[model samples]
Target chain A: AQSVSQHNHHVILSEAASLELGCNYSYGGTVNLFWYVQYPGQHLQLLLKYFSGDPLVKGIKGFEAEFIKSKFSFNLRKPSVQWSDTAEYFCAVEAAGNKLTFGGGTRVLVKP
Target chain B: DTAVSQTPKYLVTQMGNDKSIKCEQNLGHDTMYWYKQDSKKFLKIMFSYNNKELIINETVPNRFSPKSPDKAHLNLHINSLELGDSAVYFCASSRVTDRFGTEAFFGQGTRLTVV
Candidate 1:
């Protein structure tokens, strides 16, 4: 069974601060990576994804992730964050068709 | 318009009762899934159905049954619910073909609370 690990369970950052959330997965096959964010009282929305192509993929709200197959990591990064960016972020991977394995989410608290 | 939707966004029930969470997707996707997010926000896949056929059944208990009436809907029925079943359930849909760059879209999640 494939498993995902998120090193940061909770992250606190001030506005305009750079951010990096570590994510690692245990899968040897071809894997698809994704980053989903959920604001307070809002549904989960896609931040970014990596299927095939460039190792670094950009997403909404100035977020991006680099898929490193050798290290089995897909870490989410942002140059600067806003107060509105405070939300729970989830890292998920799909080795099979549509079934996804999600990591323990990291709650980001961006203070202004 | 919302791509995926779930009914009874907040469900409060007693233990030993039966409950159902209905989900519908208008994206015309062929695959749908059920995921449970625990109190700690750990999301796990419970079941997956493709074209109304069972595909992925994770380590979920037998009490949780997913019924897909068609390709656009996948409803989860829980029998003999327990306190451990109290969690937020999310419904998601995606294209069945291993299409690159296509990610599953999730619903507003039904928060189920069992007493």
Candidate 2:
């Protein structure tokens, strides 16, 4: 069974500040990475994904994640964040022929 | 229309009671999953079914069972629930072909409270 780890359980920053969240997964084979965001009282929405090809993957809402296979990491980043970016962010990894595993989410509280 | 939907968004029941949560996906996906989100926001996969067949059973207890009547509907049933079962349950679906970017579409989640 694969597992995921998120370095930070909670993060706080002001609007217009850059943000980055660390994510690491344990899987020895090919894996697909994803970042999902859940707003207050809402469902999880896909923020970004990395399957193959280029290591850097761009997603909706100016979110981007880079897949570093050597480090077994797929970190989410945004150049500038807004107050609306306050939410719980989850990092997930899916190995071939396995169930998707999620990391302990990071709660981002972006103050305006 | 909602891509994935779960019924009874909020459920509160006694410790010994049994409850069921229903989930359906209109996206025509072949895979569906049940995940639990604890109070601290930790998410873990409980069960997964692909094309109406059980695929992943992530070491979850037998007290929780997942039933898929068809490809689009997967329901979770909990028997003799305990206080530790109080958490948010989310239903998600994805395509087997990775056509949907292999990203699971999630429902609004059912917040279960065992009193």
Candidate 3:
């Protein structure tokens, strides 16, 4: 069984502020990590993913995440966030068998 | 064009009613999945199908059955829906890899409300 834990349940920030969402997973063997964001009324879209090779992965909208294998963490970061960045972010992990287990999610509110 | 789409974006039904949610993906991926998002925004996998074959089925109730007619379509049917079944159901597709899919594409999600 695999599980994902998102440290923050909700986050509030103003425009131009730095944002980081912590995510940790419990799984043995190789794993694939991903970050997905769901805006107000939109579907879940892939923000970034880490399969192999590079530890740092860049995503759309100036977002990025670093997969720290030692820490078992894949944290999402944005150097500076905009009002449009307000949304619910989810961290998912797939250890094997094409099953993706998701975290509780972090709701981010960016004020203009 | 929408890569992944689910029909009945919003479904409001009553207890004891049987309902179904349809999902379709045009990306030609080999695997499709159904996930449920609860009130607390916790997402959990319900089922997964690869090439129209059931690959994974989580420990959900027997009332919930997933049907994959083809590689591109995966449908979920719930019999005798309960209040607990009210949640957003999302469909996703991906190409299966050795460990898993490299990336999964998700649908808009069907907000199911049982009143």
TM-score of 2: 0.54
Q: List, for all models, the DockQ compared with the true complex.
A: 0.04, 0.04, 0.04
Candidate 3 residues lying further than 4 Å off, grouped into runs, are: B1-115
Minimum summed lDDT over a 10-residue window in model 2 chain B is located at B95-104
Q: Could you report the Cα RMSD, in angstroms, for every candidate shown? A: 14.8, 14.7, 14.9
RMSD of 2: 14.7
What lDDT tens digits, residue by residue, belong to model 1 across residues B32-91?
888887543446678888889998898988999999989999999999999999888889
Give the clashing residue pairs of candidate 3, or none: none
Q: List fnat per candidate, in order.
A: 0.00, 0.00, 0.00
Local accuracy of candidate 3 as per-residue lDDT tens digits, B3-25: 88899988999999999999999
Error of 3 at B100 (Å): 32
* Candidate 3 CAPRI assessment class: incorrect
TM-score of chain B of each: 0.93, 0.93, 0.93
Q: How accurately is candidate 1 docked according to DockQ? A: 0.04
lDDT of each: 0.83, 0.83, 0.83
